[model samples]
Target: MWISRAGWSVLNMLQLIFTLAWTAGLIGVAFVVLLVTRQRRLPLRMAARCWVPGLLWGSGAKLVVRGVDRVDWTRPHVVVANHQSMMDICVLFRAIPVPLQFLLKQELSRLPLVGAYAKAMGMIFVERSSAREATKRMREAAQLVKAGATLCVFPEGTRSHDGEVLPFKSGAFQIALDSGADVVPVAIEGSGKVLSLGGLFRVRPGTITVTIGAPLRTVEIADRQLLAAQARESVVALKREAA
Candidate 1:
């Protein structure tokens, strides 16, 4: 039987409440573990790998992952992906086997538990107000990646409202160049249908497919723009394959 609009609204509200509670509890436990161990990577990875998948499952969303074996697990990568929905984060966390750090806006650093966790886990925050500061942060992030930490970046800068891949920004590609790490393009599909921009509280049961493309070697690429465009094309191709 099809649910009425009002019934669907009620169900969405219940799911939202449960998701919030579940997130809080999981983060709380992870925070405590971090404090006790005084370790960042292991705790953060454990929390993310566990909580994110649980979040998706709690919202009645299934995940189909492809090309995960293409990733070279021995070395770090600058993983770039097209942004679609908030669920993209959960999907990436659940799909990627490596411990991944994010390049996030500085504003997110002000968020409560999430901010604290990000800080403790060595996630880089880009301060857009000052170019100097942002460059320094990016350099630090690149160094981290060089030292064997996989970094995930949404090079489109923001989520896509229309489920289309936006233009790729050069920052992520620059990081790959600076760190001499391979750029891994990832395509995320169907997340927008589950929970889209401006519809966070109206999540619907669905499946999200994540396709990880083979890494793009950036060592000889002098043009960041070209690298970004190439990466974007790879992601677009993967999206088509997923479709």
Candidate 2:
């Protein structure tokens, strides 16, 4: 199921281009419609419901999410997931059953249209160079969670090239701690295989499993490093289960 035939690579690239083109159009329209209607989060909900599912289907990726019952979807929580491929972004969007925003890299927020779209979606950008600024944004993210917004953070900071579950960074746990919200560890398996051409970022048509583990309580976790370690353990275990 994970194999990517060389013959299909070209088709995958073409499909990726086509799907992205149409998806971007849909997102742009969603934004405009929501802005005109004075709607909040409806655009993101629409993307999750219509655009994302279509994108995944177009890529021929069957997303199977396990442990859905573990999460209390009615409330806000910090979702800390291990990073892999670009497909992991789509997988998380589709897997998490809620209106979500991300803690995106500051660099990504510099992209022309992407930055605009992400900000419109209420996503927060992390400025890695300035610790003070980054912490300020994280506090803002914590406030968002307090206001009942679910946010996702890839604690690994970057994607893993060898599919290894990297040690999670501490920043994600800080959001949970600051917001007084639980930490949900998400393990995404097989995302790398679906985009197997590495930097090419084309879909190879495969199955991706997203495992949402039971929410880890952050009530007494004052140390971000400890919380990060605990979250990493949970993610690693879930990854093993899905694999």
Cα lDDT, all candidates: 0.86, 0.86
Off by over 4 Å in 1: none
- Residue-level error in angstroms, candidate 2, position 79: 0.3
- What TM-score number comes out for model 1? 0.95
Identify the candidate with maximal TM-score.
1
Estimate the TM-score of every prediction. 0.95, 0.93
- Candidate 2, lDDT over the whole model: 0.86
Error of 1 at 63 (Å): 0.4
lDDT string, candidate 2, 158-201, tens digits: 99989998888887688899899999999999988887636566
